[model samples]
Every structure is written in structure tokens, then in C-alpha cells.
Target: MSEAFTKSMARNIFFGGSLFFFLVFVGLTIHTTRELPERDHRENINEMVVLGKKVWEDNNCIGCHTLLGEGAYFAPELGNVYTRFGNSKEAIKGFIMSRPVNGIPGRRSMPQFNLTEEELEGIAEFLKWTSEVNTANWPPNIQG
Candidate 1:
């Protein structure tokens, strides 16, 4: 009831706040651990998807495009590219094959990586798999 701000009062407040925040962090961690498995769509991952991921990494696709909102923002978000391309893997592959739209003054274009057919297929499959993941409506629109 004393008006004086004593050391004990400050210490108690610090410890209490730390405990509360620590508990909150623990709870959030547990919730995320439990929810991620259901949202990640890991069951659909296969050899093609794996290969696609390898191609993506090897080519540094993330250096330009953002996948599920994680990567550089120089290019479009490709998290839902499969859906945006009419849910067709072939369309995705065709677009990738026809890259680096040249002759446009000051227009940014995707560089052609000269990906092999198998790599193309794998990348398309991997993108398709990413599109199926439950991102809670990430990218916010069909344009992505």
C-alpha cells in the first residue's frame, strides 16, 4: 500500500511479466507445432515435387520470386501460380519454357533457365503441391 517505488516491487513486476510472456511463447510454440503438420500438405510430397524443389533451389528461384511469402520481392508470389495458371501443370511448364520476355523497354522479365523436361515437370509438380498447401488464403488473391 506504500506509495514508494521499491526494488522489491520492480523485481516482482519484472519476474511476473517475464513468466507471463514465457508462458505465452510456450503456448504459441505448441500450437504452431500441432497445426503445421495439418497445413503443410506433406503427404502429397513425392519424387517429382522433391526434384522440383531441388531445381528451385539450384536456380535460386527464391532470389526473385516469393513462395508463400518467403523470399525476395523482385518478382511475383508463386505460391498460387498453379491456380493462377488455370490449375494446369502443362501451362505452368509452358510458361517456364517461354521465359525472359525480351524487347520490352525497361520491363522486368524472368530469365530463361533452360530447365530440362524432367526438371520442368518436377518444378510444375512442386508448384502444384505448394498450391495445395493450406496457407490460410495467403497471397490474398488469385493473381498470385
Candidate 2:
């Protein structure tokens, strides 16, 4: 009811707002930690998946393509590529191996890396693993 501005009122408002936010932050942190494991979707740890991740990094696939909303958007999102390719790792590998080297004119394309069969398979496995991860339905479409 006081019309006059006071330092005590300002101090109380600042402290009250900060305390409310700090409690909110702590509650959210606890909830996230408790829910994380339940939200994890990784079914198994396959050697192929690990190898595929190595292949992906070695080739710098993230340089052009995004995985789970990370990396460049110049290329299609690969997070759900396994699903897009009909859940077949072989199909994914075939698609990658089929690209033309240095790309083709009049078409946005991926260059052929000429990867070995094992490496190609590895990349596919990694992509499959990524697809299985829980991204909360990212990309919002199956095309990703």
C-alpha cells in the first residue's frame, strides 16, 4: 500500500525471485537424472555399433550430415536413416556406396568415399544404432 519506493522492497523482490528460480532448477535437475535411464533406448552394445561410430568420425560424416539434430544440415538427417532405409543395415550401406565420386551435376549429391566393405558396414551399423537412440521424435518427420 506504500506509494514510496524503498530499498527493502527491491531487495526482497530480488531475493524472492532468485530463490524461486533456484528451487526450480534443483527440482528439474533431480527429475532429469531420475528419468534419464528410463528414457534410454539403447538395446545392446554391439561391436559393430562402436566400429561404425569410429568410421563415421573418421570420415567426418557430421561435416555434412546431422545426427540427432547435431552437425551440418547441408545433407539429410541421418538420425533415423536406418528406419528410413527399412531397418536394413545392408540397404543403408548400399545407398552410401552407390553415390558418385565428386557428385553429379544438377543434383545435390554425396561423394563416394570408396570405403571398404567392413567400413561401410560399420557406418551402417552406427547409423542403425543412432536411429535406435531416444531423441524424443526429433526431425518431426520420417524423411530424416
Candidate 3:
């Protein structure tokens, strides 16, 4: 081969690299699409779950708690709260309902949000739905 650099060589290198990356991207897309059904967790979605998510967002729960490893860590991880609370929706509801409206003195507490029974149930259902998600063993422990 000649020692001289040429425009054709530069063009070939650029085109070759671009083609290699493009193929890799396409392969990854195909693999993800093929596996997406197994990961189709929308089966857990329901009216109550949707409403619960609404409540979660409306109340700004993320401001204090983490969900699926997102949001603040000031509070406990609620992603697994359903399981952590013994997988009992009633218990979760009760915990929320039992909170003092104005909060307790000298204690970092969750204030009462005055949610209706249905709303409370919805939130519980949402948390339950969240708990069932496969997080690849995230939170790293049962405490989460």
C-alpha cells in the first residue's frame, strides 16, 4: 500500500465506522423489542393503580420518599412498601390513615393527607402494583 493519505481512505473509514455503529444500534433495538413482551408489566395497571399514581404525584410523595430508586431518600423506599408492610393493602391503608393531620411534635412524621377511602385504596393498589415490578433485586434488601 502507498504511504500517502487520500480522501478516499478517509471517506471509507468514516462510512465503515458509521455502518458498524448503525448495525449495532439496529441489533440492540431488535433484541429489546423481542424481549419487551416478557417485560410487558402493564398487566398490573388498573384504574385503582392509575388513580394511586395520581395521588402519589399530587401529594408530592417523591419529595420525601424514593420509588424504584428515584426521588429523595429522606424517607423509606416505597417501591417495596407493599411487601415490606406484609403484603397487606389494609395495613398500608391503615398506616396512611393513622397519621396525624398536622404531624406530631418533635418527630419527623408523615402528615395526614385526608384521602378518601377510595383514594386511600387506590394509593394502596398503586403501591401494590409497584411492589410487584421486577427491579432486578433493587434496593438490595428486604427493608426497601
Which candidate achieves the best TM-score against the true structure? 1
Q: What TM-score number comes out for model 2?
A: 0.87
lDDT of 2 by residue, 9-57 (tens): 9899899999999999999999989877756555565888888888888
Q: Give the top-scoring candidate (lDDT).
A: 1
Off by over 4 Å in 3: 1-17, 100-107
How many clashing residue pairs, candidate 2?
0
Compared with the true structure, all predictions reach lDDT values of 0.95, 0.85, 0.89
Total backbone collisions for each predicted model: 0, 0, 0
Query: Which candidate do you rate higher for lDDT, 2 or 3?
Result: 3
Can you write out model 1's per-residue Cα lDDT over 6-125, one digit (the tens) per residue? Answer: 999999999999999999999999999999999998988999999999999999999999999899989999999999999999999999999989999999999999999999999999
How close is every model to the real structure, measured as TM-score?
A: 0.93, 0.87, 0.77
lDDT of 2 at 57: 89
Better of 1 and 3 by lDDT: 1
Decide which is better by lDDT, 1 or 2: 1
For each candidate in turn, give its C-alpha RMSD to the true structure in angstroms: 1.6, 2.1, 3.3
Task: Give lDDT for model 3.
Answer: 0.89
Name the Cα RMSD for model 2.
2.1
Worst 10 residues of 2 by lDDT: 36-45
lDDT of 3 by residue, 1-144 (tens): 566768899899999999999999999999988876656487779999999999999999999999988999788899999999999999999999988646457767788899999999999999998888766777788797
